[model samples]
Each structure stands twice: as C-alpha cells, then as structure tokens.
Target: MENDKKVIALAVRATRRREQLGGLVLVAPAVVFLLLIFVAPIALFAWRSVDNAEAWSALPRTRAVLRAWDGTGGPPEPAAAALVADVNSLDRSVAATLARRLNYSESGMRSMVIALHGLSLSLQKPVLEQLIALNPRWGEHRIWQVIDNESGRLTPYYLLRALDLQLRDGGLTKASDQDGTFRVIFARTFWISGIVTLLCLIVGFPVAYVLATAKGWLGRLLFIAVLLPFWTSVLVRTMSWILLLQQNGILNRFLIDHHLISAPLTLIYNRTGVYIAMVHVLLPFFVLPLYGVMLKVDRAQIWAAASLGARPLAVFRHSYLPQVMPGIVAGLVLVFVTAIGFYITPVLVGGGGDQMVSYFVAFYTNSSVNWGMAAALGTLLLIATFVCLGAFRRVMGTAAVSGR
Candidate 1:
C-alpha cells in the first residue's frame, strides 16, 4: 500500500509539471510578440537619445587628441593639428556630413567646418595659427570645449536640450531664455490633453448614463451612435470638423442665414477647433468604459437609498458614483494619453502655436532629421505616459483593496 501511494504521488507531480510547461508554451508567443513589436522599438528609440556616435565617428583622431586636453584657455596645438588632419582627410561629402552633425551642437559650426575644409588643403604654418587666421572663433575656448565634450559614445546633450537645459562650464544649467521652449511645449501638451479629457468627461458622462439606463432599442441606438465615429478614419472625422467649423463653412453659413451672428467666427485653426475635434474623437473612449461600468451597477441599491430619505442627487452621488469610479479613472487615463500623442488633428485643424509636442517630434524626425532630439522628445513623452499609467494602477489597486 505504501509503494502504491508513492507511485500515485509521483504521477501527480509529473502531471502538474506537464501542465505548467504547457501554460508557459501557450504564453511564449505573446511574450515574444510584445518584445519584438512594442518593447524593442521603444528601447531602441530611448537609446537613440543618448547615442553620440556621429561626432566620435566623424572626427576620431581629433576626438582622441582633445579627450586629454583640458577644456580651457584655447585649443592646444596637437588638437588643432588633429582637427586639420581630420578635415583634410574628409572628402566634400564626408566634410559636409560632419559639418551638419557638429552644427547641431552649436550653430554656425557647419560654416566654420566647411571653411576649415577649404583652408586645410593650403595651410603650411602652425595649425592653430592658420586656423585662427582662417576664423578667429577657432581661438575661442568654447568652440574646442564643445567639440571635446561632445566626443563620446554616449551623451546627455539631447536629453538636456529636451528639458531646456544645457551643459555650461562643466555643470548643467537652464538654457538661455530664447532657447527655453521645449519645457513650455511639454507643459502646453499636457494642458491641452487635460482640457480635452475634461471636455470628454463632461459631454460623455450623460450620454453614457442614458445608454446605460435607457430601454433596449433606445440604448442600442445610442450605443451605436457613440461608436459610429470608429467606423470612419480619424482623418476623415477631422476634415469633416474643419468643413463644419471653418469661417465660411456649413456652421457659419447656417448662423448667417438665420441672422444669429454679425460675421464668421474664428473657430478653425485655433485652440477651440483643436478641442472640438479631439473631444469628438476621444468621446467614445470615455463613454464605452463608463457605459460598461454603469450597466453593471445595481439599480435596486439606488432605489433603496432613495427610499431611505435620500434625494435623487444624493443617491447618485452616494451610490452610483462609487460604482462607476473605476470606469471614470480608466476613461480619463485613456483619453489623456491618446490626446497627448495627437498629431494629425492638431496639425491640420489648429494653428502653429496650438501644435503639441508630437508635432515637434515629427518636425525633428522628418524635417530637421535630428534623430537624437526626436528620440529624446519621444522618450520624455513615453515617460509621462508611463507615470500616468503607474499612478492609475496604484489608485485602482488601492480602491480595490479598500472595497474588499
């Protein structure tokens, strides 16, 4: 009997192990998919923010020489010689490429570098003297300092610039007032997203509540209406809003025909238009979650509260609101995150000043071709989204524990 029991125990252990292995096999594809599609791309993008390969690659000899030279007084003779040699070695194409890379660190560097390339061919005197004669700025300590500081496999320059900060005199400091625009733009993006989320909540809550409480056919109709926007492309919806909101479009024309306004209102190409379009696009996100939560709420509990001398408003505030709080939180997070990343709607419908941080990310990536700066901006936006998501998870976890 003891031997039989041992055999049964071993059989149970083997069976459990097989089940665990099967479960892992089932989940392996999903894990691999996320790593490849989502996590890998984001990690690569964040890496680009600190990757400083261009400078080191372009001026390898100069960088090696300057690495030892203290960034003070003036460019040393050896460093100057190395720079001239590096410039002389480069063909026009390579020199131009290096010039463009250096210019990103300091303006006018491209011109200085191109000029140096020309002067390097005919120079015979001391390299520093020739360089100074070519351009007096070469004698300045700051120029050499920038080159030396930027010659690294990794750098904080792009990340610092994203936050409107810079390296100066071996310490990080706020960039000049004229250059301090990125932080302000980030704040504007957050502010606009918050406003759009708030507008969606205000407008969508009633619609969701009606859908949740209405009779069968009416509820279905309202739910379908709420989801109708999802059928069309976002670009189509935004363009439709433009046609309706433009100064001489359908809305203004109707108001004029009805004698309700003196002139066409400035609606399109402004913050008002941006808010309207974003809220319309994001409203379904809010309503669907709220409707789902509200549908499960116990109407009998609300009725019992009303029977116990609670007013309708008190019953809603005390009973209905708590049940739907999770949905509200979920919807708020979804809408805010989505709004922060909005690109086309703001670009097409709003003015330049109203454009969000994503617009600048695209500008750097596509137009300016500054991959480092673009990646830095994208990283910051990703961090902001993750922070919000973490806060939401924390709050929701606390709410769940408290309820239990």
Candidate 2:
C-alpha cells in the first residue's frame, strides 16, 4: 500500500511539471516575437542615441595622439604628423567622409579638411608648420579642441542637443538661440497632445456613459458609430476632414449659405486643422476604454445613492465617477502618447511652425541623414511617454485605493 501511495504522488508531480512546461512552450513564441519585433529595434535606436564612431573611425591614429595633448597649447608635433599620415592613408572618398564628420562638430571644418588633403601632395617636413601655413585656422587651439572632443567612440552630443544643451569646454551649457528649437518643439508636441487628450475626454465621456447606460438597439448603434472610424484608414479620415474644413470647403460654404459667416475661415494648414484631425482620430480610443469600464460599474450602487436622497449630480460625482477614473486615466495616456508621436496628419494638415518632434525625427532620419539626432529625439520622446504612463498608473492606483 505504501509503495502504491508513493507511485501516485510521483505521478502527480510529473503531471504538474508537464503542465508547467506546456504553458511555457505556449508562451515562448509570443515572448520571442516581442523581443525581435519591438524590444530589439528600441534597443538599437537607444544605442544610436550615443553612438559616435564616425570621427574616431576616420582618424584612429590622430585620435590616439590627440588624447595625450594638453588642450591649452597648439597641436603637438606628433598629433599633427598623425593627422597627416591618417589623411594620406585614407582614400579620397574616405577623406571626404572624415571631412563631413569633422564639419558636424565645427562648421567650415569640411573645407579646411579638404584643403589639407590637397596640400598633402606637396607637403614638407614638420607637417605642423605646413598645416598652419596652409590654414591660419589650424593655428588656433580651439580648432584642435573641437576635433579632440569629437574623437570618442561614444558621445552625449546629440542627446544634449535634443535637450537644448551642449558640451562646451568639457562641460554642459545651454545651446545658442538658433539651436534651442528642440526644447520649444518638444513643448509644443506635448502641449498639442494634452489639448487633444482634453478634447477627447470632454467629448468621449458623455458618449461612453450614454452607450453604457442605454438599452436595446440605441446603445448598439451608438457603439457601432463610435467604432466605425476604425474601419477607415486614418489617412483617409484626415483627408476627409481637410475636404470639410478647408477654406471654401463644404463646412465653410454651408456656414456662409446659412448666413453664419460672411467669409471662409482659414482652417487647414494650421494648428486648428491639426487639432481637428487628431481629436477625430483619437476620440474612439478614449471612448472604448471608458465604455469597458462603465460596463463593469455597479448600476445598483448608483441607483442606491440616488434613492438615499442624493441628487443626480451628487450621485454621479460620488458613485459613478470614481469607478470610471481608471478608464479615464488609461484613455488619456493612450491618446496623449499617440498624438505626441503623430506625423502623417500633422505633416499633411499643419504648417511648418505647427509640426511636432516626430516630423523633425523623420527629417533627420531621411532628409538630413543624421541618425544620432533622430535616435536621440526618439529616445527622449519614448522616455517622456514612459514617464507619463508611470505617473498615470501611480495617480490611478492612489485614487483606486482612496476611493474604496
């Protein structure tokens, strides 16, 4: 009998282990899929934010020599010789690449580097004197300082620039007015997103409440109407808004015909157009989550509050709103994050001044071919999104516990 009991216990343990392994196997594909498709790209982009290999790779020997020099004086003789050797060893195309890389750190360095390449053929001994003779700028310690500073394989230059700051004289400082646009752009991005989220909340809450409390076909129809936008492409929906809201478009013409206005309003190609399109697209995001939460709310509690001599407004404030706070927080975070990163609608409908950070990210990635700046901007935006999400969760968690 004892042997049989031990056999049964062993069988139960084996069965549990098999179940656990099966569960893990079922989830393995999803975990691997997220790692490859989502996590890996994000990691690569974050790395690109600080990856500064161009200057170092192009002037490896020069970088080694520069590391030993004191920044207070003129370039040392060995560093100058290393620069000459490095320039001579590079092909013409590679030399041009080095010039471009240096130019990013200091404007006009490209022209100087290219001129040095030409002077390399007729070079004399003591390359330092020849370089100074070839270009007066080479005599300045600041010029070499810029080169030495950028010779690292990794740098905070792009990330600092994204935050409207700079590394100067081995320290952080505020960027100049011209280079300070990034902070303003980031502010604008968040400001617009916040406004859009507010608009969606104002419009979505009542609609979701009606949908949740209504009965029969009316509720179903309204829910379907809210979701109908999802069936259409966002680009198509934005274009449809343009057709309706543009000057001399259907909306303006209708208002003019009805004597509501004497002239067409300037709507498209501005912040107004951006807001209209974004709110229209993101309203459903707000509505769906609110509707789901409202559905789970206890109707009996609300009615009980009303029955106990509470007015309609009081009942709603005390009994209904608390239950729906989580959904409101979730919706706000989703809509704000999505609106912050919007590119297509903003580009198509917004003026240059109204464009968001995502537009600049695309500009750097595509037009400027400045991957470091693009990645740094993207990382900053991601960090902001995560911060907002964390704040929302913390606030909601507190509200949930306190309300109970």
Candidate 3:
C-alpha cells in the first residue's frame, strides 16, 4: 500500500507538470500575436492622439523665449521675439490653429494676429512690450498659460475636436456651428441603432417562438431556414437588400404592379432603407440566441398552466413568457451590440444625414487623418456598449430573483 501511494503521488506530479507546460505552449503563440497586432497598434495610436506638441518642437526660437518665463507674468522681450519668428515660419492657417490651442492658456495672445499676417513682421523686442502695454490684458496669467500649454509637443486638441468641444481662452467650449459638430451624428446613430435593435427583437421573437414550439423534422427544417443567411457574407446580404429595396428594384416593382401605392415610393437611400437593411442583417443574431434558450425550457409548466383552468393566452403570459425571458434578454443584448457598430449597411442604404458614429470613425481613419478623434469616438461607443450590456444583465438578474 505504501509503495502504491508513492507511485500515485509521483504520477500526479508528473501529470500536473505536463499540463502546465502544455498550457504555456498553447498560449504563447496567441500572446505574441496579440502583442504584435492588437496591443502595439492601440498603444501607438493612443500616443498619436497626444502628438500636438510638434509646433513647439519644430520652433526652437519659441522654446528659448518661453523657457524662463513664469506662468503668471506676461511674455518678456526675448520670448515675444521667439514667438514672432516661430509664427512667421509656419503657414498662416496652421499658425492660427496653433495659436488657438495656445490661446486656451494665454489670455492676451495678440501675437496670433502677427502670425496670421503671413509672418511678414520683424518686430523689435520693444515692439512686444509696447504691444502688451497697449493691450494690458496681455500681462495677466492667461497669456502665460497659453504659452506654457503650447510648449508641449502633444495636445488633446484632436480628441476634443472629435467630441465637438474646443479649449479656448482658458476654458473648454462647444465647437462652432460651421465646422460640423458630432452632436447630431451621435444622437442619430444611437436612435437608428435603438430602433433597429427593437425591430429585430419584435420581428425575431415570434419566429423564434414558432421554431421553438415545432417538433421532429419540421422543427429541424425551420431551424435550417433561419440559419441559411449564415452561408452568405454580410456585405452580399446588404447589397441584396439594396437591390430589392431600390425604386426600380423587385420589391418596388411588385408593390407597383399590385397597386400597393401610387408610385414606387422612395425606399432605398433613406432612413427606412437603413432600418430594413439593418433588421435583415441582424435578425439572425436575435433568433439564434433566443432559440438556444427556448430549446431548454421545460414545456410541462406551460401545458400544466393550460390544464388548470387557464386559457391559452393566459398560460403563455404567465408561464411561457417568463420561461423565455432569459432568452429575450440575451438576444436583445447580442443584436443591439452588433447593430450599434454597423457601418457598411448604414452607409450603403442610409443617406448623408443617416450616417452613424461608425461612419465618423471610419472617416477620421481614412480621410481626415485624425486618429485621436477616431479613438475618442471608438472609446465612447465601447463605453455605451458596456453600459447597455451591464443594464441588461442587471435587469435579467432581478427578474430571475423575482421569479424564484
């Protein structure tokens, strides 16, 4: 017995060591791949969002002047000359943007005007003194704040721009109406995604219920039909909706021939088109999860309710719906999360006004060269997704406790 015990302990140690080795070997490749592809790029791009200090780094003259200056005092003669020289070297428009960023900290930065005048002036040091004296506002802490803030190479300007806010004259404020703000775009994205998610739940719930209730070969056949869309690419499916929903497309032609309406009606490239495409694409997400949970429900409770003086509708309301509530919550979470991140379907079917937050994020990445703003928007979407998911889970948890 003693010998057998020793052998068993040795075997157990050997097995544990082997398992640990295998686990490390399995995870090492994925860790390396993620570090290279996902982790590295996210860190790099996050750094890019703060890369606004280029102006100060590029202009040594400006740095030299502002180096010794205190934050409370106005710019001295040397600092003023350095700033003028720095402004002259850059393009007027670029200079103006930099000045605006700096102006958030600096109260009386009239040097921006000199910079805007094509860097033409060769002002003496005393000229700056006179300029500040003429505009006594320059001597305040605000002017020094601007210079100090702009001294850094990286700024949070682009991130703020993406949110449609700007730092100006020592404070953050809403962006001008002229340069498109994100307020409307963000609201529309949420509204459209919400509507699409609700439609998916409404349309999919009945289908899932029917599929769940079916038995034998008939149930299997119905399940296959729901799963059929999985064989096609999302882009292909979206394009098919576009073809069918267009004014001259098959759907319109059928409606027109059947005299459903006066004209073919505008369906494609509008809000309605967006909804149709999104619902069609996302229906699968809703049905599959609901079907999974519905399959596990004990049908005895439902039939027992019907047997005990309860009507069919009452049995469903009191017993069947409660059984399927978990599935409904799961399906809603899945469909809403997927819909919120939709870009291709909305872009293909939605008009300029219908474009969502995804559209803006893509635009920033591809056309605007503003990754900071893109990251900011992506972060916002991620936060929104987590919040919704958390709420769904909490509600479901409460429902489960109440049911118990």
TM-score of 2: 0.93
The TM-score values for the models, in the order shown, are 0.94, 0.93, 0.77
For candidate 2, the per-residue lDDT at 320 reads: 88
Assess the local accuracy of residue 299 in candidate 3 as a C-alpha lDDT between 0 and 100.
Answer: 88
Candidate 1, which segments miss by more than 4 Å at Cα?
1-7, 118-124, 177-179, 395-404
lDDT of 2 at 41: 100
lDDT of 1: 0.88
Sort all candidates by TM-score, best to worst: 1, 2, 3
Native-vs-model 3 lDDT? 0.75
Compared with the true structure, all predictions reach lDDT values of: 0.88, 0.87, 0.75
List candidate 3 segments past 4 Å from native. Answer: 1-18, 59-76, 84-150, 177-180, 398-404
Q: What does candidate 3's lDDT look like per residue over 177-244, in tens digits?
A: 43556767777878988898899988999999899889999999999899988898889998999899
| Candidate achieving the largest TM-score | 1
Rank by lDDT, highest first. Answer: 1, 2, 3
